[model samples]
Target: MAKEIERKFLVSGQRWRTFADEGIAIRQAYIVAQDDRSLRVRIYGNGQARITLKVGHTALVRDEYEFEIDRDEAEDMLRHAIGNVIRKVRYKVPHEGHIWEVDVYEGVHRGLVIAEVELASIHDEPELPNWVGREVTGESQYSNQSMALGISEGARLHQLA
Candidate 1:
């Protein structure tokens, strides 16, 4: 089984931009969004698409299964998604031997920047960059699933930040 182990943080400053690569635009939507498991479809700027199934309740680790799908099928699934489609640009930044994915949200969730670093194991602790602000690892409110489902509330929260 594929396990996803990562830590999430709020981006504090613009320092990360210096090390970030050209970002890729991404659009994703949830087909099944339950508390413990979720099915998501994502389309990238390169026209590639994928459908992922994630199962587990823990924040740091989850069983993940991803499969490539036709872009048209993915778009069709997005239309039937449970919540609002998420739009963001993801940039990869290498820091201290670890690659951090920084997601800059657009559309309704603009101004929200989140950085996530995936680890080989749950015990691994990657060095945090200076631009990383508060750690929001286990916060469900900051999860993309929650944001997509509660668009209005999420937008308001980010606007107030």
Candidate 2:
């Protein structure tokens, strides 16, 4: 099984923009979303698509399987998804040998900005960028699945922690 270990943080300031490239627009929808499993399809800026299956209950690690899919098929799946489509622009920023993926949300999730870094192992400690704010790693309210399903209650646009 392929496992993913990552940490998520709320973006603090605009400093991250200086080190980021022009972001790619992303649209994702969840077909099945539960506490331990999620099935989702994502479409990228250039029309590339992928289907992903994630299983886990922890904040720091999860089992993730993702594969490329036909654009038409992904679109069809999105149409039948259970919740609102999650729209965001993803920027890749490299700092101190670690690449961070920053997601700036759009549509109903507007004003949300989050930064995430994947680690090689559960014990790995990555450098924290100054632009990174409160760590929301295990907070289900900040999870994409929860946000996509519009289940985040009082999820304000402010920096957490």
lDDT of every predicted structure (CA atoms): 0.89, 0.90
**Model 1 lDDT per residue over 1-161, tens place:** 99999999988878999999999999989999998999999999999999999999999999999999999999899889988899999999999999999999888788888999999998897888889988888888788988888744553264213
Query: How far does residue 53 in candidate 1 sit from its true spot (Å)?
Result: 0.2
The parts of candidate 2 lying over 4 Å away from their true place are none
Pick by TM-score: which candidate is best? 2
Q: lDDT score, residue 42, model 2?
A: 98
> TM-score for model 1?
0.94
Per-residue lDDT, model 2, residue 5, is 94
Q: What is the C-alpha RMSD of each candidate to the true structure, in Å?
A: 1.8, 1.4
User: What TM-score fits each model?
Assistant: 0.94, 0.96
Clashes of each: 0, 0
Cα-based lDDT at residue 129, candidate 2: 95
